[model samples]
Target: MPKPSSISEKPHRSNTSEESCAQRPHQIVIVGGGIAGLEIASNLPKRTGRTSIAVTLIDREPAYVWKPMLHTIAAGTSDVSQQETSYVAQARNRRFVFEPGELKGIDRQGRKVYLSPTEIAGRRVLPERAIDYDTLILAIGSAANDFGTPGVREHCLMIDSRSQAMNFNREVMARILETVTARNTLNIAVVGGGATGVELAAELIQLADVSAYYGAAGLRDQINVTLIESGPNLLGAFPDRVAIAARGRLEELGVTVLTGARVVAAEADCFRLADGRQVSAELKVWAAGVKGADACAKFEGLELTRNNQIVVTPTLQTTVDSRIFAVGDCSSLPVGDAGKPLPPAAQVAHQQASHLIRHLPRWLRGKELPTFTFRDFGSIVSLGGYGAYGSLGQFGLFTGGFLRGRVAQLGHILLYRSYQSQLHGFWRGGLIWLADMINSRVRPRIRIPD
Candidate 1:
């Protein structure tokens, strides 16, 4: 890997249309089309003074989905299509170029990003290529970290992406339809008491209920869900009372909750605990912790943390290269008086994107950048339709109190709506929400993909 140097050198100019004139537009290439990357691409100013700003977004997936809702999609409770925004369409409408490819490598010296060949059904459709950029931003997001546990790669299913979520849904639906006899039970074990695990456990219960309603008889009775947390409580990020409330709700809904039960290994049919006991399950999901993509470590020679996250300054610029920036789950920057790394959450990504949207144009015009400050708006975890809980951290001044029940649930829904409004503008985004409401009334509540 080449070592990163000063970002003063301009990239080699190509005879592309954007550079055909005497003065070329300042090229900005953003890798990853997740929450932060897409927002930055959509909202960035198209021009900085007399020079035009050319932005390009690259990603492996063709469409963008709100990753926080993957659990609902995995349980077949929500339609992925309703939430998906095509990269092609978004780029066209937002005045940016979209390239469908994964980041292969970066040439910091040359200011070029190399992308891997794009494939469809195991065949390559586009050859590997490189794109030059005056500024590069990485927001590829994070993935589940198994902590090197044995058999986890083969035995456990992870819902880090849309395809993975759909794959889990298919297997779950197949198992639900197979439970014809009361003697056979579909046992599921979810490892991780974080928001993903707890929410998925509740969604699974709802999945059983929806399955039975759709003529898959006795699914509720024939399904067993066990939520195992290595910590003493679920939703460890939330307040203790919220965690207690979530645990209580899951228990009341027939979920087996196990706290402080560390998983030693995942076998073909069960999760072996460190205490010499095993929790048997036919389907297993691992959502315990997240780390930046392992592939991120291979990107150029940028500084990385032990978890593979790119290290960035408080301004969101990479420590090694001033022209390169990283945000979202893929980047690590410590803030606050405690100097703790920011938590991996949607709000963090959104705030970072908004920061860049405000500061990048000023940066282009050669102005000093300000440090990015994150305002804590608190966190909310929704357990499908069972209930919701939230704590307003710095935002409590406006709310006047913590939230729960329908009010907290409304807050959860509004977060996604606000995201859509930011991405699609208010009018089109409102139409999208209205369309979803109409679809919910007419379409089947559950999706059993073929």
Candidate 2:
């Protein structure tokens, strides 16, 4: 790995005819190719005048997956291999440079970022590179927070990414088959009563049904799913009625929704609860909490919150430097009503990306940047094939039940589609949607053997 160059010595501006032509187009480097990062890249204005801007998107993964759909993958309902979008191809079509590299560190003083070298199949591919930028956006997203519990990092699987979720799905299916063949009981424990954990628990029930359909006899009867949470109630962020209804729905599916149960230690095949209860399982999933990625904390000279989220003002600019902007799970922007940092969710990230797309060009041209105000579009958590539950309206006065689940699911699907529309025009998005529908009809509902 080569050392990164100092930002001070790096060329900040060029003095060619192009440089003198209008305001030199600023170089915008965006980290992370997730929903937020990709949206920002796709919505960037094309270079029309002397002040053109270049956008480079960086991510460690080769493709992008709609993260909210990870639960579906874990439940064997969706195949990640077919659903993933190649970032390289999308970047080319969207007119941005895509760099597949893990972000190592950032030098705000020099306005440059150090990217780790990328390797594939034990062969070195892309060497370490330093990207200089006039404006930087950090949308690296967040990972599952384990809360430093024992054996969590080693034993439990987190469905935070496509590969991880797919691997978990394979492991789960294999375990189901093994238990059935041996006539042994199958227990799957999910830690975190939050939306992801609840949805995954529900999906597992549906997956059991699929397993039975595939000739796995007595699979549904033998399978047991447990959802653990430290809070007194599930979906703590939502209305009490919604949480209570969700618990009942989960229990109806034979999933054990254990609230106020804090997992203190995770073993290879079981987790010990704070109440000294031992719950053994064939598989364990940790989806309890989330914090910013490890790389975000390593960013030097940036003001971050206690959770390592970049501290940003109302304008979404980092407190340490105005030239750098942060969004998504990696940022902690002040919220309006709550007087706290905005919650990290897809909706907030989407809103922030849309705002940046509209105002970043103005900021580059020396115009004042507009303050980003987040709209509280309430959350909807899918309850597998059964239904969905969540609240809507300005103050969440509009409570929804099972039917709202379908609507919530559709809304979630549209969120990703909206991102697709930004990347590919509406016509292209329509074409992609049609192709997906056709492929779904022709292909097997579940993935074939790897």
Please state the error at residue 371 of candidate 1 in Å.
Answer: 0.7
> Which candidate number has the best TM-score?
1
**What does the lDDT come to for candidate 1?**
0.87
lDDT of 2 by residue, 1-450 (tens): 112122233244455533553465567899988778988887685622444788899998888878888888887877787678898888888888998899988876567899989999989899999997777899999888988898999999998877788899899878876887898898899999888888899888888777666777678889999999999999877778778888999999999888889899999879899999989886899998889888887888888777878888888878867667899999997765766778788888988988888876666655677678776657777886788776663544443433366786786667667767776789998788788889889886665445
Superposed by TM-score, candidate 2 places the C-alpha of residue 400 at a distance from the truth, in angstroms, of: 8.8
Relative to the unseen true structure, what is the Cα RMSD of model 2? 4.8
How accurate locally is residue 201 in candidate 2, as Cα lDDT from 0 to 100?
A: 93
Residue-level lDDT of model 1, residues 173-214, one tens digit each, is 777767754448989999999999999999999988887777
TM-score per candidate: 0.94, 0.91
| Runs off by more than 4 Å, candidate 1 | 1-22, 45-51, 181-183, 396-400
